[model samples]
Target: MGRDAPAAPRMAAPAAAHAAPAVGDADRRRARDIHVAIVGGGGTGAAILHDLTQRGLRCTLFERGELTSGTTGRHHGQLHSGARYAVGDTDIARECMEEVTILRRIAAESIEMNYGLFIALDDDDVDYTAAFERACSESGIPNRRLSTTDALRHEPGMNPNARHAVMVPDGTIDAYRLPLQFLATARAGGATIRTFCEVTGIDSSDGRVSGLTVRDYRSGRDERIAADVVINAAGPWAGSVAALAGVGLPITPAPGTMVAVKGRLCNMVVSHLHPPGDGDIIVPQRNLSIVGSTQWKVDDPDAIRTPPDDILRLLDRARELVPAFAGAEFHAAWTAVRPLSGRTDAGGRELSRNFQVIAHASDGAAGLFSVTGGKATVLRAMGEAVADDVCRFTSLAIAGRTADTPLLAHREFFRRQERVHEPV
Candidate 1:
């Protein structure tokens, strides 16, 4: 996690002549008129909205709060290359690899291309390390073994007990910049985004979704927006969103707590090549060191706070990797809920990381869909999958061109505009 800078300048509202067209399929001669409502403005939802708008679909994004005010904004910014799950979760590893490469290419402005290291602190785990390296190699991820001396030289703050390290292509990402950049590009491509709008109800007749009722939190005004389709990409709140439509979705909310320190303890991402455990990874961001995390199932995503005991446990484990991190000033802490789907009795950690696209048409309801599960690094891939489903149901012939298109081009126009209005 990084320190929160002053909020970016707000863009001017669309002109009256540029308002979204009225709701009518025939009147929607241009893609800007075929309205699609997306609930939740987190990374997954934002990525989906970007992809949809880029493919010429009119999109409106609704968030109950600011963009990325959910799990997408509350995470250790390490961009995994799928190596972390190679030991037991090969499926997640594969997905991570594909999306990691794609995001590095498309969203260059939001990524830091630093490599990651997984260190083994004891000789007893050398065999496990070797097996893990082999698994990564077989899974198409490149892993190189680093000697203890070499590892210590690279990261002087590393624990002297660290005996071996494996280097992989992992990097840190700006979670804040990632979604904001997506929103900027989506809006540029003609998407309408309304923050602080909370979706209250789903209006359906004849078993088909017709529109959505939303309340502007700031003005306390209620309004309804007609839409051809309603997508639930509310991260941990997906279940609640479905309930508004009288549908049941089995989404389990799992919360993880992370701590941010005042400075970088290591120049690259460092992790323990072991099962899910507390403080197994340390990620370096702009001016802070992010050490996390502890996973526990929760009932509400909004109730996120870091427990003191968990914070102590994290510091203890982190010191084993970097001894200099022992007394680093605690800057801040936060929690994010991971949306898991499966039988509640099956356990949240056991649930697959792969995402699922649910269409209500098969269950007697039409024009509604729900996307759940998966990590932030793989959001673009998930967006592609959901967009394909939406196009099939809408009878739209738009092709999925987002995979090859760069999301946003660096332009001098925004820089010049910012300079003109910058506060002294």
Candidate 2:
């Protein structure tokens, strides 16, 4: 969708960190007339809340657990430059590059622009270099080819046997803080974020969504909330949410395992130079080096168990790229289920990484929508796309301003004294 969207801004100075702009009295009154409910409290939901509120819309978000308790909190935190998907899907690649530029500007405090390198570990990897670089350039992702010596200079910990390397605009994100910033700003704009509140039923009538039945864990009571529209942003659990509304979503909960080791083995993100696959990415977060992941589809997002063999395969792969990875002390091993876009017979590697906003109007649920797939890097874009669709569905002309609006710091989310998990 980003390929057809308007051109993105060029890289520029980061936006000055600021609180959310105040909403006008008239705008607030108008927004209150049409309340929208969002399911899930992950990054996509957070961004959706922020975007809708910024566009002068009344919004409330529901999360069964603490915010970011799902897939959002468990990611390896690589702020992709689109290079990983460049060779296969240039559109998604360009979209990532666009979001990277925007996030650097609006959410600068939550990012680390340490960059990334794709190193060739074998002759086959070296053979893929020319095509990879060309694809990146064609997709508007900046890249640089480097010899083994040059690559080692950037990452002294890398394997000395690396045949060559390529540099891209990859970076690291504070997986928790980035989404919290969106929530913080959304709160400042009058969004109601309810955590530990589970949506048990979708209230619909005459092929239209009317409201929701929710269980408030904090108060041990069930309550109903009226809404004009409902957006399912439940990530890997989107299918289950859609089933509650008597609709179907083609989401695959593809789980991947990641292993974290003690010490920062590399300052920059490192990956294999070949195609995207299992155990390819090694991201440096704070003082830990994280190597991920192995992909396979599962029916239940909640039932995922990190395989012991995945840890071994990841460390072995990490060692191939960074020789020191083998000796690094093991820290943790976990799995994060990806909300991949489609159902597949094979491992989800064949599924496109791009997200989709599916309006359930055709399924006899006029006011229901589900936003699924996509990576953390394009959360803002995912929000914008869904918000735009919501506006069109409601015949509202409000435009999204999230791309230009700077978010409140993640710390601000906690500084506010107001309670978020009140009864209903």
Candidate 3:
């Protein structure tokens, strides 16, 4: 699991913004030697492709739907400053802090750096405020303590009765566009991207994953792809993907429902200063304020039914954070599945937010690895970690440069060039 993996650089690799390498010109001979197939087209898969291409590796990705169709797109889009996890999971918090800084430097275009505020609704929350600052400081997350007056002045939408609030470096991410920037960079660097492709079968020989049978969901065309490595970056569906290869992964799908209401109630991200709870976060996205979320385990990621009660409850909670939220126009509601590593004995909230990169070689399947869990805030860091494992398996000494790589601008993800998206 996460027990003994090599450490990757905490800083981002330098980005090649103006002069990204031409597509289809990557060393074909080298790519043929270590062909890798990454499944899923979410943030993780896109990041992996970016990492692999940065190392000049030959790789292809298959997404069952359009890119960011899963959790990546449905998320509340908080570009975490690691403040949320400081009290519960310091390691992940620290990673988020570093990755957020790196992302701001490399992919600044995809982030809305509006910052955040941790408000104390009452005296009990006041007590927790000290703990929050302490935890954030311990995790190296920068924050500023604010008096009740300053807090209310900064965000008039906050509860008038609130006691204290702290400022943190939280921001909003363009969930749909950020990942595409990575995929676009990969495409520019000679990687293949296949959308609407679902893995129908995992074909292995000699106790190792050798190929995959993928069906184009949009066209119903079946295609076989041979690969030296297969990475499962399927997020909440990672367990399902692993099962096809006859591997058992203790992965639990945790679905969280978020509701978006019209109007940006606050310019800053507002979160409860207490323990993790449903409807505790209200993030401003574009012109709307999104309240997220309620978490519960699920048997199937695709089958999770959105609970209407959650939406109603969130509105009530949002009213606590912002009085205007009471009459805010309804926007949209959706559920996002989180890939939490299973500890059968623990509840969904009890599991660590830290990600796990599993090597299935011990589980009787070589050349197969599964990456599950973690937040979108650390997608590139997670990608680097996964690439470290891939490097070990392929005996490739490629260092990760994703942190510094300026991906194709988020707006240009779909702007196909002459050589981009060339067949691998």
Candidate with the greatest lDDT versus the true structure: 2
lDDT of 1 at 306: 71
TM-scores for all candidates: the values are 0.88, 0.93, 0.92
lDDT of 3 at 244: 89
lDDT for each of the candidates?
0.77, 0.88, 0.83
Stretches of model 2 off by over 4 angstroms after superposition: 1-29, 422-424
Residues forming the 10-long window of minimal summed lDDT in candidate 2: 8-17
Better of 1 and 3 by lDDT: 3
How many steric clashes does model 3 contain?
7
Number of the candidate with higher lDDT, 2 or 3: 2
> What shift in Å separates residue 296 of candidate 1 from its native position after superposition?
1.0
Task: Order the candidate numbers by TM-score, best to worst.
Answer: 2, 3, 1
| Highest TM-score scorer | 2
lDDT of 2 by residue, 286-344 (tens): 99999998998889999677999999999998998888997899999999999999888
Give candidate 1's error at residue 149 in angstroms: 1.7
Clash numbers, per candidate: 0, 0, 7
